[model samples]
Target chain A: AQSVTQLDSHVSVSEGTPVLLRCNYSSSYSPSLFWYVQHPNKGLQLLLKYTSAATLVKGINGFEAEFKKSETSFHLTKPSAHMSDAAEYFCVVSDRAGGSQGNLIFGKGTKLSVKP
Target chain B: EPEVTQTPSHQVTQMGQEVILRCVPISNHLYFYWYRQILGQKVEFLVSFYNNEISEKSEIFDDQFSVERPDGSNFTLKIRSTKLEDSAMYFCASSLWGTSQETQYFGPGTRLLVL
Candidate 1:
């Protein structure tokens, strides 16, 4: 079984300050991890993914995450927080059991707030 | 870039009524999926379709729910009877391949409210 756990239910950061959102996972096999952002009344937008490739993955809007296998963690980070970065972030894990039928498992999600 | 699209952005229905949510995946994509998010809850996967058949489905996709790719370009999820618990935002997603390495693009989603 595969599951994702976002450490924070909500996070607030001041504009121009650094931001961090923590996520942890449990999987039996090698997993595919992803971070997706959703704005109010909008669809989910992919931020980045780690598929056994580079541990440090870069995403759109200057956001990035590091995959640490030992820690069982994939934490998203950004050097500077912007107003547009306010949204809900979900950490997801894909099941790798069946070769071609991996369904995504999503976390409860972390709501981010940017304070100017 | 190509993206997945869904129809009926919002729908309100009475209990026991049937409802169908539609989706049009990106051209050339072979895998399609349906997911939903209830108020104050995590998003949950419902089903996945490929080659006009169901590839995988979750426990939430019970007898009341059925999926079909009636035409070449459209995929639909039918709820035989609407229940208050069924009210949620349903999302449609598609990926070029079913591999774990592939990225699944999602649509804006349909907000279904059951009365």
Candidate 2:
């Protein structure tokens, strides 16, 4: 079984400050991880993904995440926060298993709030 | 850039009524998928389709739930008898290939409200 746990339900950061959203996972096999962002009334936009290639994966909109196998973590980070960066973030995990092929296991999600 | 699209941005139906949700995936993509997110819950994968057949499905995809690629450009999901618990946002997604390495583009989603 594969599952992801987002450490924070909500995170608030001041504008221009650094931002971090923590996520952890449990998987039996080598897992693929992804970070997706969703704005209000919008679709899930892919921020970044890790497929056993690069440990430090850079994504769109100045966001990035590091895959740490030993720590069982894949936390998203941003050097600076912008107003538009406030959105719902989801950490997802995927691995080959019965009836789970090509399916992603999504976390409960973290609601990010940017303070001006 | 090409992207996936879905119909009926919002739909309201009574319980026990049937509903059909439609999607148009990115043209060059070979895999299609359907996912749903109940209010205040994590997004859940319902089914994955490829080569005109179901490749994978979760436990939530029961006998009442059926999916089809009715045309070259359209994929559809049908719920025979919707329940109050069926109210959720349904998302359609597509990927160039049904591999873990590929990124799946998603549509805006359809908000279903089962009364």
Candidate 2, residues B1-115, lDDT tens digits: the string is 8888999999999999999999999998989999999999999999999999999898999999999999899999999999999999999999887877678899999999999
Model 2 chain A — which ten-residue stretch has the worst lDDT? A94-103
DockQ of all candidates, in order? 0.70, 0.55
lDDT of 2 by residue, A1-116 (tens): 88999999999999999999999999997788999999998889999999888899999999999999999999999999999999999999875632234678899999999999
Residue-by-residue lDDT tens digits, candidate 1, A50-103: 888899999999999999989999999999999999999999999775355678
Count of backbone collisions in candidate 2: 0
- Superposed model 2: Cα runs more than 4 Å off: A97-101
Candidate 2 docking DockQ: 0.55
Evaluate candidate 2 and give its CAPRI docking class based on DockQ: medium
Q: TM-score of predicted model 1? A: 0.97
Worst 10 residues of 1 chain A by lDDT: A95-104
| TM-score, chain B, predicted structure 2 | 0.99
